[model samples]
Target: MTKDIEQRLKNKDINPTAMRLLVLDFLMQQNAAISLTDLEKGMGPSDRITLYRTLKTFEEKGLVHHIDDGTGTTKYALCMEECDADHHHDLHVHFYCQQCKETFCLPNTQIPEITLPKKFRSEEMNLVIKGVCDQCNPD
Candidate 1:
């Protein structure tokens, strides 16, 4: 598992330092997108600044992508393998469960291409749907 984590980091051209390795491994185990505060809690005694920097580096390297689910806090999730430093291909819809307060990546649902006005340019795009998740409904 450690080797796999290291390889993932290397594939993104990120150095697999001890802190990075631990952060990536932890992210891999998550079932939902996580906020920096939640990550700090989960890491247990790790420096918040280091973790934030690690997350920022991962985002820049395309190893992860941050989402704003309208909760006023950014959440991070692992990007698909096709993502790289130059481009991110995980342009999928995100779901935020109101009941559980968890955010999820809906990779199977791709965002449709939008044709903007001639002078306009798009830097980034995000769509979030808020509802109760399956675990919270279970009916």
Candidate 2:
């Protein structure tokens, strides 16, 4: 976990602190993407404001990407490419399980490009597919 945090910090060219390390470790431990609530639950006694600030910093540094699954919850996943402290890879699909309500990152799946009206600029795009996950299906 420590190594993972160090690697992420180094990749983002940021000096990792204890809180950052802990947050990064928690994110790395998850098999799926997670929300701020999930992070708070995982951290136990962590301060909410502190966690939010940490997440904001990580997002700004491009160590994480925010994914809105359209369930009134925002989740985050680690960037696939070696993103710089200011850039991120925003073209990926997120999977949300209806039964478990957990979100997973579809790493190999790429989000299709959509043509927008003229003069429209797209900085980021999120595509979420909701259904019962394999674990929930099990049939």
* Candidate 2 residue-wise lDDT at 134: 90
Error of 1 at 100 (Å): 0.4
- Residue 9's lDDT in candidate 1: 96
The residue ranges of model 1 lying beyond 4 angstroms of the native Cα positions read none
TM-scores of all predicted structures: 0.98, 0.91
lDDT of 2 by residue, 38-97 (tens): 999999999999999888888888888888899888888777766656567657788899
- For model 1, residues 1-139, the per-residue Cα lDDT tens digits are 8999999999999999999999999999999999999999999999999999999999999999999999999999999999999999999999999999999999999988999999999999999999999899989
- Candidate with best lDDT: 1
Worst 10 residues of 1 by lDDT: 130-139
Output the lDDT of residue 3, model 1: 97
Name the lDDT value of residue 62 in candidate 2. 82
- What do the candidate models score in CA lDDT, each in turn? 0.97, 0.84
Clashes of each: 0, 0
